[model samples]
Target: MIKVSVLYPNSDELIFDKEYYLNTHVPLVSKLLGDSLKNAQVDFGLASGVPGEAAMYVVMTHMSFESLESFQAIFEPNSVEILSDIANFTNCQPQLQISEIQI
Candidate 1:
C-alpha cells in the first residue's frame, strides 16, 4: 500500500470542507479512475508543528500504486483543477508525498 500524502500549507483560515471533500470530491475522484481506485481515505487537518510555524494542513491517501496511476498520468496537467476543490479552504499550495510499499 502506497501512502499518497498531501500537505496543505495553511493560513489562519485553513479549514477543510469535510462535507464536500467526503461527499463530492471523494466521489468524483473515485469515478475519475473507475476500478483503479480502491480503499480510498481522505484525511483533513492542520499538520502538527507547522500550524505554529505558519499554516499547514494535510491529506494522506493510502492507495495502491497500480490502481492510482490514472491520476498520475494526468497529475501535472490537471493538478490545479484537481486540487482546486480542496483548496477552497486552504491558504497555500499543498505539499505531496508518495512512497512505495516497503513491506
Candidate 2:
C-alpha cells in the first residue's frame, strides 16, 4: 500500500480553515477518489515533542491506496477540480508526499 500525505505548515502569519477542510474539502476528495482510495485519515497538529514548541504543520491528510498507479489514474484526471478547491478553504500552500506503507 501507499500513502499520500498533504501537509499544511503551521505559521502565525498563515491561515488554515479547519472547518472547511474537514467538512468540505475532505468529502470532495473522498467522493472524487472513490474506491481507489483504500482509506483516509486527517491529523490536526497540536504540539511538537518539546513542551513549548509548536507543531510543524497545522493539518495533515493521509490517504491510502493500493499503489501509486492506482492513485495517479484517478487523481490525475480530477486534479484540476480538486486543486482548485484549495482557495475556498485556506491560504496555506500544502506540501505533498507519497510513501510506501511498511507493515
Candidate 3:
C-alpha cells in the first residue's frame, strides 16, 4: 500500500477549524478519491514528548491507496477542487509526503 500524508504545522498565528475539516473537507476528499482510496485517518496533535512543549504539527491526515499510481490517477485530476477546499477549513499551508507502507 502507498500512503499520502498531509501535515499542518503548528504556529501562534494558526487558525484551524477542526469542525469543518472533519465534517466537510474529509468527506469531500473521500468522495473525490473514491474506491482507489483504501483507507484514511486523521490525527490531532495534543503535545510534544516534552511536558511543556507543543506539537510540531497541529493536524495530520493519512490516506492509503493500492499504489502510488492509483493515488495519482484520482488525486491529480481532482487536485484543484480538493486543494481549493483548504481555505474553507484553515489557513495552514500543509506539507505533503508520499510513502510506501511497510508492515
Per-candidate TM equals: 0.61, 0.97, 0.98
Cα RMSDs, all models: 4.1, 0.7, 0.6
lDDT of 1 at 87: 61
- Candidate 1: residue pairs that collide: 8-57, 10-55, 10-56
TM-score of 3: 0.98
Tens digit of lDDT per residue, candidate 2, span 1-103?
Answer: 9999999999988887789999999999999999999999999999999999999998999999999999999999999999999999889789999999999
Off by over 4 Å in 1: 46-58, 67-71, 74-81, 87-89
As a TM-score, model 1 comes out at 0.61
- CA lDDT for candidate 3: 0.96
* Candidate 3 lDDT, 56-87, residue by residue in tens: 99999999999999999999999999999999
Extract clashing residue pairs from model 2: none
**What lDDT does each candidate get?**
0.58, 0.95, 0.96
Which is better, 1 or 3, measured by TM-score? 3
| TM-score quality measure for candidate 2 | 0.97
